[model samples]
Target: MEDAKPMLLVLSLLVVAILPTLRANIADFDEVWKKRAEDAKKASLEAYDPHPERVTQNVNEEVHEALEGDDGKRRNLKKYNGPCTATNPIDRCWRCDQDWASNRKKLADCALGFGRKATGGKDGEIYVVTDPSDDSLLDPKPGTLRYAVLQPQPLWIIFAHNMMIKLSQELMVTSNKTIDGRGANVHIANGGQITLQFVRNVIIHGLHVHDNKAGNGGMIRDSFDHFGLRTRSDGDGISLFGATDVWIDHISMWNCQDGLIDAIMASTAITISNCHFTHHNEVLLFGGSDTYSDDKVMQVTLAFNHFGKGLVQRMPRIRWGFVHVVNNDYTHWLMYAIGGSQQPTVISQGNRFVAPPSLFAKEVTKRGYTPESVWKSWNWRSEGDLLLNGAFFVESGSPITNLDTKDMIPAKPGSFVARLTRFAGALACVKGKPC
Candidate 1:
């Protein structure tokens, strides 16, 4: 028994001595594993192609021509140049121009006094459209006398669902026009059937635009057609296009099929601050279709916004512009925080992102798809992929540079309360006022 015990001890020592060598071998194998992972990551990034065709081409050119006129030259007219009237310093001239183009036609009609006045007064006098008879707001009968009195105050179009006033086509607004809804409850239900076309210098604020879905289903037409294509019964609560120096503040957007807010074409110098955005496809998007290339699309700022739950799609999808996204809270996004075309430089700084593993799980389950499948479909990488591959994976093909995540407020997964605090803090700073 004693001899057998000595033999057993010797065997144990031998195994221990060999163990280090075995570990060394394993370490060598680990290097190979790391190399393979890195190679795979490189391949994945290379393979990722957004199928640029899916993006409408030459959209910028068409939109520019439509808005700026055919010579591709901007008018230096003094009427077009001025600081915005909004109290926020971030609001600027370009937004005013964009607003003008969006609703010019509508304001022209109002200025000409073509519609029946719910309140009888001289033509061109400011009136309110509170009922279904406001079709006069869109197309007034010919020879409708131009209103003799120009109301110094902006016109207000208040639409209740029962009003049945279909104000769908894009309204071209005149300069110094403002359209205010009394409150967020003022609903425009499913008026998406109309196409709102070219106009300028208008403001549509403090209204809930839901189920105003209009647009051909993802078809490529003229740049205007792109508007119709992206249009959904689920259109944004408020949308600004081809205009500049505009302001959208203190609004809430939820459950919209598209972005909560979007700006396209040569739109520039816009500011979206102090807004609560959630439950939508995207919070914001900048730049226009791929076909256009102009430097003016740059210089937009999205700051001090609160983003949280019910958002089931991308965050800010941007392209061909310099977008400053700062000091916001983004929680529970189904996909990337900021993404879009390979062009345009996006600066995302001082924003907090609070996502839990469970949020990812829930998002995956809601889509009835696995995380791997989603990654494959979008050609995206997961955070864990960094463990296998190197951190270099983040830099590959990333259009956004100067991204700052440090000092971001952290929150647990699915903790809406924590998200709100983070968002509130950021919003406070951005608005330069109380949250």
Candidate 2:
């Protein structure tokens, strides 16, 4: 009993010492949050695309022309002579260039869909990450990924070599940053996940992020000017909270503890493209809550991705907002795919959905927390989508008119998806050679 008293006193003293720092961090973050919230609101408003279907049509035409010739006829790949057979427009922009290593910034212009304007760190200097360790959160080493992302200035971050980074806490990324993991094999696995909170204009490409675990957070540096006490993190592969103008492409992910990618808390103007997802549940979530009505302004584009085997449900279960699910390949799902609630607008176009052999779960759409009377008015439409093996999509709301069809239904059919997503997921890029 006498020794217990000393231990209690020691613990109380430690708490007393830490309280001041925690309080200061909280106060500082309050101020930062206010400013960031305003910035995110303004950016999201400016970045929202009301007619994103036009962009999808443009890309579809490009992909069609690439696979078939300009004469709108099919071509035999066996007779092709190009250095790289880039199937899609985004990949065609940089994949075939021999000098891609030296001109890496050119990739910023390759983004399409709602996030096309996210020129992440394109005008900023290149910052190479030579260290794979996240030893310190407050005073991170100079050449580490933590340091590269925290800098207030825009930076194009690339790796020095093939490396695996096991983070100790959630990696907080700042605005105007690009984590480009090309020309090297980089993996973020078996540790903490990534968090993009209250930032804008970020691009993450060409990496494998899997096996993520939740982080017990403390004081973590979000930017060079801000370090705050963060709480325990959700174990998502990537979490976007109140962020805008973000693009995530060419990533291969599986076995995360939570949703593979989540965009919530009014996050908008984002794109997830050319990625491969497998062995995950609740694959994507757009809105965190049904009551968070501010998510009505959210707009996202899911393009040219491959949802492979071992996936269960929520190939993006949305809540409120506008989403364009375009030109993707879905080969497997144990449960219903592409679900929603709260009267969101979802337009599924030019995609392929192959249902599992089980007849109980072949439906493509699932509406939650709403009765048939309410959800029947929601704008959920599927155009040019291929449903194989008894798969189906339940569409609702008013029939689209010719005026609306002019802006909405120009995308190619699902038959083109096989060629469009042929090179999905991360690619192996060698210097002086095509990817």
Candidate 3:
């Protein structure tokens, strides 16, 4: 074992020497990242308020008051009396229409919370992906999924048939693109994952993204006009790097090498809704590092998701941001769920949390290494959540009062979470019927 130390040192030095050769040089990365970061900070601060969830609470209170009966038992308010029972407000916006396939752009208008303004490809032409192969990282074929996402013009991309696309490199998506997988069973697995870097106004819906592996850094095209050298990926299923106004809905993700979804580097104004996540360790991560103080402007909404079995922790572990965790179903976790650091604001309202059977880990929140003296002032609140199986949440900071509710939308209650998230994952939708 003493003689083998010299060989190990030689191997480590050789690996370090050869790593830089794999990177292809792109001259404009710093410029692009800086510009996008500035824009994201501006947009996020414009939408920021001290108590962001105040609007949601006001709307919910008004709704209950209007539906109250003579005997003080609240009557059920049937917002959508259609054939299909779309329980949640997001699903009720468009799921009841029989012509959803023809009017596919209408889904862009149905987003709530911070991502409500993300109009992905709403004014663009429809581009159907006829090929599922991602054989080339640069100069892809015209009818391939890679080509459609790299086009300069805004596109509402759809699949022609059921396909299992194995990407050879990271799929770098451009701005103003919508990849809609409603009418087919589209799966992106067993290879590189999706990357949204320095882009905005993008929506990804109805896809299965799982089983990803990191790729060796190489030259890849991000848009029609440009291609850049990418570093080795971290293997997240969906990575948002300096991205804003993004909406991800109805994606089934599991078994990735890193977090299932990661939004970092000042990414804000995003919503992740109605997704089914299972069989993963670290689930979601927002605000990558504690020292990235620009993340103070970050704001996101995690709504109506089903955090199912085989998960460990970080059903978002956030830093320096305001996160509205509303109406999600947390049924399993091996470790503590919903962690944070760096004085972030978390408003957990109307969620169901069923703790794991472990007696050592029954708490729902973990404030990462920070002492009580430092973290006691952080605004972390739990309102109207259903805690079961000896679960508990640690609340801190003072509650806000008399917030202006001029134009705000309410999030649904956690009592109806089972019904609201009944169709959390990707759905099998026929062309003419309601989805």
Candidate 4:
């Protein structure tokens, strides 16, 4: 007891000496994060689609049901039974209930990103795609996926039976439409791919899209009124060009000829969630060109997706965009994952990354096509990420080491990522059963 006083004094002095530097570092981090947050909000509002037929809300103002309660408390399903209520915030918004089929439209409210306002045909007619054929690009048949997409009216599209749809040309999805493949085995494969250009308010869900081939774009009908000449498509599973307010969920894709999903040319307000990606290279890209600076307003959210098996790089290689990549699981990669260039701001939070065995490729980050002298200034933060199997993230930009503040508590502990991403893909559900 006599020696305790000296030891206490020494510890107090040490803390006094270190506190100033720690506080400075934390303040700097907070300022940087604050600016990024403000800029992201501005971008979301600036890119808000002004389509007269629909109301698109500001993406940042929306609160997800799973993340916050009515009075703003984080919620979990400890009170509920069966299949373990999803801990991932998006899944908890509507996954545990047995009435998901009946309340299918509830999925729209769970969207988190620039595209959060995409209610998708909820206010319109329900159209069923009964045929698997796309015989003519200029004149699509009445009962096919192509026909359902081309209609100008707001529509909730569903499949009549289990089938695979192979298109002769890229299926140009029109605005304010939802291609819902739930409750059936629906697929688009060995086909000409899906194109969303100059459109708005589109939702694609619960489909297996793979083995997509390039199409020779010619005089093809894009909407109910126009058919324009075009060039050959680059054969992506899904391509978004100059589109807005789009949400893609519960998709299973593999072996596409090019990128699985490509959002380019000022596409904004987009969410890509609950999809399973495998057997692909160059998985997702946010911007097509660095010079297309109009894409600076692009704000995207990638959450609750599984980047699995045989993927190479570009788990969303972004350019000039504000992207939130949260709670996704990355299990396999031949090359590095999560790269960016051209001043993209990426926030990677609550994700798990298990790298491959190659010592040279164990790093989880790469700055694409840019010299360190330039890329070093870009903001790419990894918070609460599990870098397993010898995986390490090469961090750059402003150091955010000390965040001892209440509001800016860094993402949940990295150890918790496993539980957060466990249910990363589509739930294999059955009728008269819980999902």
The top-ranked prediction according to lDDT is: 2
Clashing pairs in 3: none
* Native-to-model Cα distance after best TM-score fit, residue 372 in candidate 2, in Å: 1.6
The local distance difference test score of model 2 is 0.84
Looking at candidate 1, what is the lDDT of residue 313?
48
Model 3 lDDT per residue over 1-435, tens place: 999999999999887554432211222455665565577567556655555666356434433443233232222433433457565667877887889999999999888777777888888999999999887888999889899999988999999999999889778888899999999999999888798876888999999999998877688887897777777777889988777889999999999988899988778888899999999999999988888897887888888899998999999999998888888899999998899999998888778899999998799999999999989999898877889899999988755332345544444456666766777889788889888
lDDT of 2 by residue, 45-150 (tens): 7777666556656565666655555331232424444568677778888888888998899999988887778998997999999999999999999999999999
lDDT of each: 0.37, 0.84, 0.81, 0.74
| TM-score (C-alpha, index-matched) for candidate 3 | 0.87
Best by TM-score: 2
Best of the two (1, 4) by lDDT: 4
lDDT (Cα, 0-100) at 354 in candidate 4: 92
Clashes of each: 45, 0, 0, 2
Model 2 CA deviation exceeding 4 Å by range: 1-29, 68-83, 400-409
Of models 2 and 4, which has the larger lDDT? 2
Off by over 4 Å in 4: 1-45, 48-84, 399-406
Lowest summed lDDT window (length 10), candidate 4: 52-61
Q: Over the stretch 1-435, how does candidate 4's per-residue lDDT look in tens digits?
A: 888999999999887555422221122234433443355445445665443112111221221333333332333413335564566656677777688777777777777655677878887788988999888788888999888898989899988888888888788888789988877888799978898866778899888999999876676776776566555677899988767789998899889898999988677889898788999989999988777777777878887678888999999899988787766788899888898878987777667899899988899998877998888788777877888999988766765443222234344544554455555544566655656
